[model samples]
Target: MDQDLNVVRGDSPDWRPPNKLLGQYLLSRLKLHGDRIIQAYPQYNETVTAAVVAERAVRYAATLQSLGVGCGDRVVVCCGIHPHYSSLLLGTICCGAACATLNNKFDSGDLRRLMEIIQPKVVFSMSDAVPQLQPALSQLATIPKLIVLDDEDTWKWFINNKIAYHEPQGIDPYTNVAAIMCSSGTSGLPKAVQITQANLFTSLMAFKHKDAYVQADDIVVITSPLFWVTALLYSLASMDHGVLLVLEFGASEEHVLGVIQQQKATVLFTASNFALSIAKQPSLNSYDFSRLRIVIATGTAMAMDTQILVENFFGASVVQLYGMTEILIATGMTRKGQRILGSVGLLVPTMKLKIVDPNTGISQGCGKVGELLFKGPQVSPGYLNNPEATAATFDAEGWVHSGDIGYADSDGNIFVTGRIKDIMKYRGHHVSPIELESILLSHPEVLEAAVIGVPHPTDVEHPRAYVVLKPGASVTADSLAELVASQVAEHKWLHGGVCFVNSLPKSPTGKIIRSELRYLTES
Candidate 1:
């Protein structure tokens, strides 16, 4: 406690490692502000302080140890957003165990597949989820001990009924797998990404930078599911900073806005769609959002106009962040720094970024569209239980392929164009669907849009678009195509044509399901 526990100690947005393990760092903060409210759950009307979280985490860690969970063992957590879930995650890591977070919304088949890969030593879930998880847990070659959260007997058995508490075990910060996060699996099957203790601690340190710093009085609201990397890391960072954290439990935009008004939240993190919904709220002006200092847009890219509109609507700086499950956060816009209109902002100090030619695997200079590659401590060790995937994605030189195509400006600000796999070819020229989709979203009548490449005889693959219009707003495909044609190059135009739809498929984090779009177009 006597030592300066600030994860970062610098004036700029540069990270300085605190030389402490993530669990060590989190527990060390208990020396200060132990009685201060650390987390608030409006859905349950529950509030917990730093002292209680630390105590619960330690007790849970001891409980896991008693269940034969040791260093490097896997513990699967399948539950919705709850304080107990956070406690379980921290406790699992504190006991030198790897916590594999399962998406609570996953179907039985997906659950079974992930469990088979994780082969967790112990499985924890809410009582409601136990029914579905039972069969999946049984399918595992080794049946894991199931712990249901909603049962009072669970607490009595794990905490209240226990007499002697086992001591928490220490972990190797660099080698210990603190958590296993699941990839989005938009392109293929979901793989478990192994995140090391050092990876998470480095991610936490990235927040201590000047423009992204969290003050002790800051109230941070997180609406994204805890399974998503963005929300999970932000919650941990807020707790590490001894700041108030609010878990909104996947609430509606209106409900979230109410919580922000009531809690006087200073920082908010949500997906672009949620931000868009908040922006489009007719009664948005009635809310007291003056206390907000920054609203971060992540999970997917926000349209340039939408970002500006949200910033103006909230009277707060709206910044875009770029990162994936493999990497915690690579680029972010600063509250007080220069924010480019369509860029994800300056690269973090912890990682190195390069744009490489997709076909030749050669590094491209600035302003060239190429596959983005990242190398740093924040990058996950590799995919768990799949050496082939680990080898396929990570190169021998240690660079992890991001599968994204984007270029950086002279100032090091990144402009994400589109996914490498999502690129379209027309007339032997490359086209990025995001450029066209962004144009469509800018239209006043369109609420959302997705673009993909469809097969063509001469053009090989031509651009096709699917658009969702705002309620009662009618727009013809010919008119939308004309609008896009007027704004883009001939080759980039929608040669494969356009279609109007009620809605586009989306992942849980709000990213467009391009594969589904491709399927629909092909069909």
Candidate 2:
């Protein structure tokens, strides 16, 4: 062995080896604890062992290979709240194929549009989602090979009849594509982000070694759907570390608390909205959350007050992570450092982050807000088949122009201000809707809030606020408007007035649909 290898294998204080392939690493953990419970789906009462999961994944890979899915072929997997979805993802990765996970909640028209855009070679849909998928499938020019999951009757027949058995071929980790995740595409059409095996492995390595929030003995509760990037990474990390994954379908406070209490989950990865909901639960104190160590909030920013309440309730700091489908989880605040509120912490060890002026493309100094750019192994190579959009987003030097606008402090902590495109220009002054929305959410009577910019008859453009009040907590529009005016500058003040609504429209991932809000205002 080489001297470096010898040091890594040896018990040295400063020697540490890097993690390589995710599948091999996870499989080795399965070999150690073959019988231990790895995945639990409460709705179905299905508990899967690490060994069973690996075997099923291998078999599924064989099935995909028979259908002509090989390296670089895109296989779109539309998943619901099924335990088998994770297995399907693993199987696709093992076969060296990229799995594009579609949101199950999309209507037929939207689904068809995405299918036409991606042009996947194969698709895997649950038996329950078939009714909704049929119309979309009919519209595709070249229909993908359909694989039905959770149909025991048909699956049993295939297994019993001695179908063709094939072995899973090992793949080169450095060059193979692993998965494709769609961005929300709030500005325009959703884009398919092609995440390679190296990208996935790099993010997992950072989470394991550099982040050090997750451990092999930790029990992780997965409250978000596997279709999303954050939830998928949590499961992959847990499996890679030989930890237990307790998954719940919905984000209901009651269901989440029950699973956490029953499983004694030590870690949780969820959206900020879900965490806020859990914090606001009337009976939150009833659950024993002392066993919890880490609470990771992504998808949206957590309110400062809500974060404090949740930390006090669980005795754990709520770590805020900044990530997207393009780069997975890039920046995260540690529990110990979370005391510095409103910051997303430093960039990951292997990653490089920069804030550049959107128009000039010049790097900005500390505290100067600009578009965030990232370059690293965790960043996706490009959008699949959309070279125009890919080239536009990724520069010649390989930096990903993340539409998000933020400034890094002198200490290297990143604070995401808002999306550059989402910034409302009122009388030539730029205003971030996130800033306005955050102040609105700070109001004790407001449960949720969203802000949008609409074309104004007199001012060219103006800000509007939509709020969902706390149950039974009454507040009039004038009062709400005054509250916002008191917090913001003259140009940043709401010109369109406050509007009370039962609920604001949200994307499948729980982000407020600002375009829809503008549409509502225009109508």
Candidate 3:
């Protein structure tokens, strides 16, 4: 490891804070103040403290063990925006079993497909989601056990009569799978990504060194759902850091600002869109954000203009992070490093990053745009049960192909251009959609935009744009086309014209589904 990136182990005589495994570190916090409120949900007026969370975790683990969930067993956790869901994930980790967090928005078809692929032994789903999953219940023949998160009466009966609550037994963290989160499925179907205990612990350690913003006294607000890796990892990192977590079921600008003021939140983890929404809120200026120290924006790329707005509004720089479900988070731009407009900052302490040519597979020098590759303890072992996809993603040397096109500057700052598969080929010339999208988004009227390649009758391909205009703003297709033509080269211009849409289709993680856009055009 580089001298600057060296971390102190827990056993070392000179060891500092944040050295233990994520589970153990969380347990220590729980032991310290079991009654101190850890998470609060305003919509339902629900709250959980360290002591209550610990007891529930222990009871849930005992319930899982009694239901035949042992070490190595896969437990599918379909959680919504609730603190209990997070507690259950921690409980599953303590029981030495893998927990797969399924997206609650997935309908019956999506659930059935994932169920067939993962073949989980047991499923823990919220009551609201259980109704949607009812159609696929028969398809999940492999899942012999099911635990509904709602039905308080049932949960009470289980705790009171079904089985006696017992403390979680000792677990070997190194050999267990802490959590399993799926890829965004932007280009294709989603793949299950196995996040082991080591992966979670390593990621938390890296977050401490790379972000290093969370503190014990900080109140961290989490608005993203627990199904995504960013939210799950943030929760774990906060727990490990012994910080108070304020969980929100959904993003409500009013509710968020209220919680920040009432709870005195010091840190926040959310998407760039959500951050932009918060910044755009006129009411935000009235509230005092003096306690807010750090705000992490992930799931989508952060535009420079949006970053500036957030910094100016909150008096805190937005920490931009580039990550995926497959590798968790490998690169992040600290609040201090946001001076470089589009850079994603340096690689994490325990991670290694490289940009390689797509055709040659050879490492590219700085400033050369190519496919980004990463290798670290936080990298997933492989896709669950998809050997072909796993083999295709991981090289012989264990580097995970990120499929993202980016370049590093001389100062070691990383800049993501676009996805390898999303790049457009116009008459044999390669074009990055992100470059076009960024230029279009710079327009005062254009709120969000996506660029896709459409088949041309004469040449290789042509650029097409699907744009969502800012509220109350009016712009014709000709004006939008003229806007791009004036800024970009003739070859890079949108020859296929702009298509107006009410809203662009996006994945659950907030990435634009360009493939779907192309499909819509062709159909």
Candidate 4:
């Protein structure tokens, strides 16, 4: 037996840790902005005040407690963008249990796979998503208590049985899991990234220091699903900043623009492609977006020209954010008037970024492209129950070896070229899929584009493009090939040719599925 392994050392240096849990922090916001309307849903024509939200969250937590949920239990939220998502998530965390979010877009098979992994204690599904979830829930060995968010009977049961609000005592914020958000499954199946309470608080603090920091009385709108880590961060940021958050489930371009005009939303958070959609929508001029001061594009990289177009049209500053589930909001651009093309902006506060050779472990100097390694308090502890992946991705010093390839200039502006796995090799020359995709997006006729390397006879590999054109827009493949060739080197040119598709496959967060494109090109 390894008796010495369990030995405890003498008193060691103790550092300051976040004193509050994720739910407690958000609950405090209610006291600060009790009278203000903190959440508005234009779709339902409903508005909820901060005080009301706090009360609802407490009651919801009591309901979970009454149902025998306690510390370390997993509560899965399987629904679309509902107004009650914030309350449910806060309630789950308030009970000292972790909240796992699942998108309603998942089918029965997908749900079954994820359910087998998470093994949640309770599952909260909106009335609309219950049908889709039933099959998966039935197949589980032990059925979790199902609570439908929109059902009147469920609400009555929770409200009648609700107890007094009780703050979880002796909870360690650093070790307590806060939420389990799924990674973008671009290369493979999505892994459950376990974010701790400390990580969530640190992420909030980092965004608090940025130029796009949420302001008091600000009306913020997020277009992405609550399941996405970025959108969840925005939700928490809104509460931390005492801002009114407006949400519309399955928001279309028209719905988003209309909500902004009607609500006079001051800040917008959305996927880069959604922002581009708003800019390209023919009815954009019909909506008034003058109240918008800051717009953040996340999920995927936005073409510099597309950023300019959105900024010009909305009369708001557009900044691109580079982050993932593993490390939430690591880097973001916040320049108000000036625009930096192809830059994700300066490193976020309390974070350190280093570039190192992917093959060799040697560090790369500034302005050199290599894999980005990030060390920060906001980084996730690791993927859940996946020690092999955890060991491969995280290091002894707590640095997350991000598989992204990028570089920082002398001015400290970060430029993400592409993912290390997404880089295309042509005759031994490296080609950035992002570079080709960005150029293709700049074309007037192209609506969406994805680039991947395909097998070649002469060169070891060749660049291929899958494109989606604007409605009623016309452009030949050869012309598109010439357009890219003029911008990049010969080796990086589109030698594998272009395929026009109705739509490019995308992850839930709107990142293009490059692996799927590669599969299509090869097979």
Candidate with maximal TM-score: 1
| Candidate 2 weakest ten by summed lDDT | 4-13
lDDT of the structure predicted as candidate 4: 0.78
Model 3 residue runs over 4 Å out of place are: 1-22, 159-172, 184-187, 252-255, 277-290, 313-315, 333-339
lDDT (Cα) of model 2? 0.74
TM-scores, one per candidate: 0.93, 0.89, 0.89, 0.92
Of the two candidates 1 and 3, the one with more favorable TM-score, higher being better, is 1
Residues 1-523 of candidate 3 have per-residue lDDT tens digits of 1223221111111223355545557778787875777677776688777787777776777777787777777788786776677677777776778888899889888888778777777787778888777777677665456667677876665444445544345555565677888774334577888888877877776645534556677788877777888778877765565567787746567778778888888887777767765775545678877898878777666656657767677887677777878788877734454446766666665677777899999777767788888877778888888887888888888888888888877666777887888888887789888768767766667767889888887767899999888677788888888888887888889998998888888766566767789899989
Candidate 1 stretches with Cα past 4 Å from truth are: 1-20, 163-170, 184-186, 281-284, 333-336
Error of 3 at 423 (Å): 1.3
Deviation in Å, model 4, residue 501 alpha carbon: 1.9
What lDDT tens digits, residue by residue, belong to model 2 across residues 1-523?
1122110010111223345455556667666778888778888888888888777676676777777877767788887777766667787777677888888777787787778777777777777778877888878888887767667765553223423435345666666778878774324677787888878877776655534566778888877776788777876765666778887756567778888888888988777777766665546768877789878777776546556766766788787788888878877734344435777766765677777888898877777889888877788888877888888888898888889888877566778888887888888799888778777766768877888888887677888899888788878878878887998789988888898888888766667777788888979
Candidate 1 residues 1-523, lDDT tens each? 0022211111233556676767767888764768888888898899988888888888888788888898889999888887776677788877788988888888888888889889999988888887779888898888998888777887569765353445445567888999998994325788999999889988887777676635667898888787888767866765687778888756777788899999999988888777866775556678887899988888766667668877888899888888989988888834466688877877676677877788997767657778888878888889898888888888887888888888876566788888888888888798988779878877778777888999998879989988888778878899999999999889988888888888889887777888888888767
The local distance difference test score of each candidate is 0.79, 0.74, 0.73, 0.78
lDDT ranking from best to worst? 1, 4, 2, 3
What's the residue-level lDDT of 98 in candidate 1? 92
- Give stretches of model 4 more than 4 Å off: 1-18, 139-141, 184-186, 333-339
